[model samples]
Target: MTPEEWQAVLLSLRVAFFATLVSLPFGILVAMALARWRFPGRQILNGLVHLPLILPPVVTGYLLLLTFGRRGTVGQWLAELGIIFAFNWTGAVLAAAVMAFPLLVRAIRLSLEAVDPGLEAAAGTLGASPIWVFATVTLPMILPGIIAGAVLAFAKAMGEFGATITFVANIPGQTQTLPSAIYALLQVPGGEERAMRLVVIAIAVAMSALLLSEWVSRAIARRIAS
Candidate 1:
């Protein structure tokens, strides 16, 4: 790959990595809450979490721009705190994270719902604290779901284009990720070859993520069975 292509790949990786890392904890927490708790507005919260998946990407991006744009309400406050997201790498990360969040939440929530409450009760009977029981028993049982969620998020981030470009505007070498780079290349007269290369890279990245998720899920299943 050319320097520019390599740079895009690396930037894409960096953005996806950080986005997934930052959102994983929150995703898990939300999934657990939705699966195991009963609270007011729980249904509303669930719908909101899945909104990006149903809404048009352009609409999601526009909403982000409105809420987090430079002159936007939250953006202005964040800017004063020395954090800027508009049209930057951070914005790209935010867009990716938002778009990928639903998938992560769904995967985790499914696993959480499937967990045997009896196991937790057993741990409690053994005098294990709630937190300790969760850490030692619940987490291990749900490891497959976590891995699946992460992989799904990573794949979604890799293919993210609409929301990202709408929010970040495709600035090369900074906020430009693989999908955006491919879009930009396709727009140029002689950019087909480069765009094709990036497309291949995108496919490879997505396939690898899916394969890894499947492998991890199977491993976790086997471990649990044993």
Candidate 2:
């Protein structure tokens, strides 16, 4: 791959990594809530969480632009604090996170739903706090699912283009990720070969993440079984 291609791949990895990492805690919390609790506006919250999946990518991007653009209400405040998202690499990360979040939440929520409440209750009866019960009894059992979710989100982030480009634009070495770079490459003559190379890289990276997630899950399963 050319240096620019390599740069795009690296930047993509960085954006996807941060996107997954930054959203993980919130994913877990929201998943747990939807799986274990009953509350008013729960459906509303769930709908909002999954809205990105339902909306057109361009629409999601536009909404993000309105919310996170430098002159936007939240964006203006954030910029005042030295944070910017619009037209930046961070915008790519945010776009990826928003697009990938629904998948992550669904995976974790399924795992949480499948867990036996009896186990958590048993832990609680032993004088464990709710947090302790979750940490000691629930989290370990659901770890494999969390890994799977993160891997899924990472893959999604790796391929995110529409929303990312809409929010951040295709700025080489700054916001151009693998998908955007590939798109840009395809726009000109003699660019198919480079675009194909990027496609391969994307596939390789996504497959690697899945394999790693599987390996870790199997290891955890073995340890738990032992």
Q: lDDT: which candidate is best?
A: 2
Error of 2 at 206 (Å): 1.0
Q: After superposition, which runs of candidate 2 have C-alpha atoms over 4 Å from their true positions?
A: none
Write candidate 2's Cα lDDT for 66-87 as tens digits: 9999988899999999999998
Evaluated at residue 56, the lDDT of candidate 2 is 90
Clashing residue pairs in candidate 1 (N, C-alpha, C atoms within 3 angstroms): none
User: What is the clash count for each candidate, in the order shown?
Assistant: 0, 0
Q: On residues 1-226, what C-alpha lDDT tens digit does candidate 1 reach at each position?
A: 8998998999899889988998999999999889999999999999999999999999999899999999989999999999999999999999999999999999999999999999999999999999999899999988899999999998898788899998888888988899888988888999999899988888898898889889889987888689
Candidate 1 off by > 4 Å: none
What are the RMSDs of all candidates, in order?
A: 1.0, 0.8
The RMSD (Cα, Å) of candidate 1 is 1.0
Residue 222's lDDT within candidate 1 is 86
